[model samples]
Target: MLYNAVSTLGLSKRLQTANTELQLERLRNNDEIASGKHFDVAKALGARTGQAIALRNLYDETDQTLKSTALLQGRLGTMDSALTNILSAGQDVLAAASVGLGQPSPTGSSLQVRARAMLEQVVGMLNASSGNGYLFGGVEVKTAPMRAVQGDESGLPSPIQIVQDAIAAATGGTSSPQTPAETAAAVAALDDLFATPSASPLGFEGGFYQGAPSTAPRLSARLDRTTEIPYGIQGNDPAMRDLLQGLYMLASVDTSQLPLDAYKPYMEAAVAKVSGGIEGVRDATAQLGIHRAQLDDIAAMNTTQLRILNDQLDAMESVDPAEASLRMNQLEVQIEATAAATARIARMSLTNYL
Candidate 1:
């Protein structure tokens, strides 16, 4: 066959183009081997690139949501622990009060002291917090949910003083109730003071609560696009109010100063109030347990969804290292062969053949 200049030039150009193409293929395959992922995901996936992007975005969002859920779970757990501690403290006071009623102590001195210490302990627990914020603050998480028992220079009456004033008002400035009628009136006044919109100027809400009010929205967390859980418990809750009221009633007066007429009726009322508070706290704790279970379920479902999403993403975007390496080796050999052929064609001449 005759090898004309035009045909030789055409052949040489084609070989050069083939060599360059093989070189590019080798480079792409090498990259795939190193990275374990498609070098150009959009190019490899074509029209389906959007699906891959959406899937990856969804995976990222779910991961973020799972992290948030974990934090919420931690907060809920912290609140539950604090509330359990409060229950324990309440029970201790109940036991002390029951013992006082069962046996005679000089003016119930031991019971009074126990109630005061436990009252402080319970208030401290109600003010518990974590990295996120205060556990019992409701929607207000930055500050302590319960005020210190001692009022500040701001002139607010201390919690103990509030209880004392309520008693004085009910008993007509007497140290203890004068009769059964006075004892009943004292209990009613104490209840009113600790009620939602307290009757006294320095009642529970006015003097003790430092967090969100009852009318404000409760704290909550979102598990997903559609699921939200409200798990906040405030210090001013009715159960907490009753428990504190019972403790304060015992702690505020010296039982030694009281006549039997006042002391017997008073101790019985406190015991009953504390008992009711214990039951209410247990119910609240049970409700928190239910919420925790719900969070566990949501977390498990999120884990499963993440796993499936990861698998799908891997199938779409990952490459096998062994296969990529093998292809790269083949491309290298083809590129070398094409380069050798192009060089041979460049060296060819009519004079050499002659």
Candidate 2:
């Protein structure tokens, strides 16, 4: 059958489409060279799209968790320093109290001064903020967990007085006793407060802690695909509270008013509490160390996983540089041939056709 005259519209459209395809190929090559990956993430992976997507999502989540872990690490680092200082202060108080038992006026004044300084330090730590939130406030991240000054129904008296009264109440009543019995009572009171703060008059509600629910959701960070870590040591923690209580008691003592015998008992009680505080802080630091180790392991796993995922993705979509260059060169030659053919075809006359 005789063919109709070549349609000019179709020829022009075909030429335009060929030129567009060439441009798109060049653009895709450039993109591959620049990105070192497939031009289209999903299309390149084809049957492997599900796994590629899942791996990408997993990496993204792991990356986000690592970021969060970094931030939490900073906060925990601050806590570590604060707790160390507090532990040291407790040791110092014990030493000073020991010395105070020997010399009445001067040594006692020194202990009191040191205790006051430590009180400031401890309170500063308790109310410390990292980034946008308080360190010791647990879930109540924005609020200060400890107050240096005294308060009314909303809060208790100065840290020392509240501790003293709590101790007194634990023994029997809040009546003043100029004896060793009072010191023992104060120790019992501290135990009572930590044990059942809400039940006791000088509970966490009335005294020191000002944070989220009593059992706040722990601050957490991602460890891996199937693991997470929870943390956020609060001010009301027995170890921290005991440390503060020791500092308060040391600051409250008056060497002149009480005889060395009475003073000795007070210091003894304070020393025991302070020692407990030191142990508590040490334990917290140790636990933080464990978390840091875990993060390191998780980070390593994340890096390895990401590398493997990237390799798989590259395999799916990456154009070999040498092959891409050869293909590009081939396309360039084809275009040149097409241009020549079109030029020759355009010049064909009706006379030549007849």
Candidate 3:
């Protein structure tokens, strides 16, 4: 078959262009070695590198979150243990008080002293600091949750008096110690205490102390953080209130004057209430442990997921040096041969034979 020379030349030129493009594509995709001024190489590397960078960032963020959760779980666990100890101490005091009240000679005076000490220890635990700040003072990190002032021999302040005074001052009228006559009157008084705007120095109003006052003098008895959930138990809570009231009543009672029969119920009631409080604390501690365990499980799962994702990313983007080296050598030889062929082809001309 007769072939056209112009067509043949065009075909040769097209074949050369196609071969050059194929070589460039292979080099770009392989990315075995850093190539200078190759657009295809940059494009290929940019795509794969971007994916790797994104994966790495995701891994890093997951790791950080896992670490933070771990820290929170650990803190919670420590706080739980402290609460358990405080509960135990409170129980011991109540038991001692109960036994003492039953006896005629009342071996209970020593028990009272021990109970007072334990209560003080409980206070210290509630104010326990986690190095960052107090754990139990709610958001008030700098201040202790409970304090015993010297006003009375009692280690705790008169909460009822404080509330009453604050309410009276806010209302500008004395509250009836007896019944309020109507629910509306009582609600109105409460509204007055709570409705005072935050702009007023008293804070969110409601006669409630949000956090320990910064300027308020420190209490002689502070809650211990090392042995209790700092501020886990509130003074106003019924269990604590009953326990304190019982203790105060016991302290005031003249055993010589009062018959054992009259005091028996008081001792029994105090024991029951205090025991209940201890159980409450134990239950709370157990719940915290459960929460901590859940957090640990979540962290472990996240870690495992991250590891798998990292491995997948590595497989997709990472190069094997040995395989890359072999491919690179083959491409180099092919490129050299292509160059030599092109040079030889270019020198050939019809005029040389004519």
Best by lDDT: 1
**How would you order the candidates by lDDT, starting with the best?**
1, 2, 3
TM-score of 3: 0.54
Q: Report the Cα RMSD per candidate.
A: 3.8, 3.9, 12.4
Worst 10 residues of 1 by lDDT: 99-108
C-alpha TM-scores of all predictions: 0.85, 0.81, 0.54
* Candidate 1 ranges beyond 4 A from true positions: 1-28, 102-104, 152-154, 334-354
Root-mean-square deviation of candidate 3: 12.4
Count of residue pairs whose backbone atoms collide, per candidate: 0, 2, 15
Off by over 4 Å in 3: 1-54, 101-105, 148-262, 323-354
Q: Assess each prediction's global lDDT (C-alpha) against the native.
A: 0.85, 0.70, 0.52
lDDT of 3 by residue, 149-225 (tens): 11233443343343344444443554321222322342243333333243324322212333444333322211111
Candidate 2 per-residue lDDT, tens place, 1-354, comes to 997777755786687678778778878877777777767777766798988777778767767766766777787788777777776777777777766554356656667788888777777777888899988777888778876634435544755567667655654664333566665666666656655345676565546666754566766665555877666777777787777777777775555455555556666667777888889888987897787777777767767777777776667667788876777788788777767766766776678757
Model 2 reaches what TM-score against the true structure? 0.81
Worst 10 residues of 2 by lDDT: 170-179
